[model samples]
Target: MVLDDLGSSLRGTLKKIANAVHVDSKLIKEVVRDIQRALLQADVNVKLVLDLSKKIEKRALQEKPPAGMSNREHVIHIVYDELVNILGGSRELPIKKQIIMMTGLYGQGKTTSCGKIATYFKKKGLRPALIAGDVHRPAAYEQLKQIAEQVKVPFYGDNKEKNAVKVVKDGLNKFKRSSDVIIVDTSGRHKLEDDLIQEMKDIFKATKPDEKLLVIDAAVGQQAGSQAKAFNDTVNITGIVLTKMDGTAKGGGALSAAAEVGAPIVFIGTGEHAGDFEKFDPARFISRLLGMGDIKSLLEKAEESMKGKDAEKTARRLMSGKFTLHDMYDQMDMLSGMGPLSKVAEMLPGGFSGKIKDIDMDDTQNKLQRFRVIMNSMTDEEMNDPSIIRASRVKRIAHGAGVENRNVKELLKYYNMTKRMMKGLSGNRKMRKNLMKQLQFGK
Candidate 1:
């Protein structure tokens, strides 16, 4: 969900070019200026933005349109490629059986990220062990132990050990034979200082980690770049993990920093759960940033979160217009696996995130629980065909579900609204066509 603003702002600027057939100097100038403004406002470096805009402007004016390609399409393609280039084309963390050191400032979610990364590797058929070298924080060791328990991975830490570097060295040797990836969670400072830097350098020298990752809070905004620089000064950072992206609008700032430091974002933390992490995908990311639906990635995330044929069946029902309250409940369960509602909404087209901005999306769990209780009280026929539930049935069902009759009525009302909305969308061919177009081109 990082860089959520880029999609909407970029779309607005590109729409101007789409409305014009011939690329004129004034149009090119306006487009460049619009891009510059959006990128700068999003906390992108000024020099980077200017350089990108200049390249786009020059290419738009000088490049000849290819056969069968319209001038608008050519310009759009150039912009997309240039933007992707600036974002650092698709890259992945070099996977191997080696030690990985996670370093960041305090409260940047390094502790959580280590477990998530371990979980990721485990899913890839590798054994991972967590090394808690963060002796500075009182509960850091226990936290890593709990996470390792939840993830069912091995952990090495000593609450009694004061020497962080020694613990890391010991953890590495102990877990080297049994684990494919050894992740060491190092200590962090409230602010960069000599002692902290020297301690980190010592840990690095002791472990000689194959990969050094900086776990950064997406909410840090423009400070993310400086933070990355500060850590990189002491230890080489191979990649970055942007944490708390599910809850931050300023996540775009982290992307800007990654771009500035030429570090590729290898992972993102969507939630607190160990399984709530995902590999960063550039195309899908750009799609999300432009307010264009990343349905492919959405489906993939859903599949990763949920298991069995249930998700595929649900997808079939949604596409076939056979979705029901029962289906909605099932979808809610899957959504829980997909992470937070805010994250899911951010992947929708036309910046649908704004609509639920004022709503408490976190109540999704509570709402789902209540809905399930209400649904359980309904008759088998009512669950399948909710249309027959008259006033009497509503009251009786409400009593059985241990909720107010009004609550049952509200659920029915919601069911009806969803049914109607889906029905309308199913019947609207133009709407579907337009949506697909937007998804393909970020229009």
Candidate 2:
């Protein structure tokens, strides 16, 4: 929620354009000033903000709107594209067999990110192994080992070993044949100390890792650039990883600072949970940041929750308007797999996401669980067809689910709402067209 306010600020600025009948220089300047203020508050470097604002202004005014697009749309596109560039253009790390070395100042969440990366690779069907090369930090190996066990991946660590390079050597040899990706978690000093740099150099010589990653804390703000440069001077970071993205209000600073260094960010830790980690897609990130839900990311998380023939079959039924309580239950249950309710809401475009902000995310999640429990108490025939569930059935189901009869009625209402919304999509041409327009306008 750090950049949440920025989205509102940007939206308010852009909303002015929506009301304007003409695209004028005055309007452009106003929007640019609003952006500058928002970025500055987020701790973005002043010069970088001014430069980016300049580019946005020039493009919005000088460049002709694309064919069939209005000036409002064109100007919004320019802002979106420029912001994406400022956060580093889309850069992907190919999922393949490789060795990655993790380095950063102490307390950058390097160890947690190590587990997250390994878990991410494992989910992608790669056999990932973690090497605990951070012998300096107490319980560092234990922390990663616990994560490895939870994610069920191979892990190698030696707590007593004083030579960090030896740990990397032994870990590589230990999982050479069994692992597709080997991640070396190296030690970090409180600051950029000589000993820590030398230790990293020693590990670099020992393993010659395929990629060196610098895990950065998003709260570091403008200092992120200097930290990135210092590490890149040594091992030459192949990519950057930002942690605690969900908590920091100065996330814009970290993002812009890292981009200033021209290092492509590979992954971002949105929350403390390993499941909250996601690949850093600049375009989608900017989309979410601007309040124009990231549907692509939403779909990706959806696929993770429900897959194979069951998911396919459910989709078919919903499209055909054959939705049932069972279908609703499965859909809501699948949502649990997608990090948090508010997080998932941010990926949906338009008023829907704004509505989510007004509600309690945890309370919503708890209600979803209650819905699932209520449905579980229903008979197969009743779940398949809700019409048969009269007052008697509602009372019985509620009693079984440990709730009042009114709760059952509320669940039925939610199911009907979902059914109508999903089924109406087939006939809602105007709604679909409006959504397309909003998505193009950055919502």
Clashes of each: 2, 0
For residue 281, what is the lDDT in candidate 2?
88
Per-residue lDDT for 65-113 in model 1, tens only?
6644545667766777777677675568656787889988889999999
Residue 208 displacement (Å), model 1: 1.8
Q: Which candidate gets the maximum TM-score versus the true structure?
A: 2
Candidate 1 at residue 21, lDDT? 38
Cα RMSD to the true fold for all candidates: 23.6, 22.4
Show where candidate 2 strays beyond 4 Å: 293-443
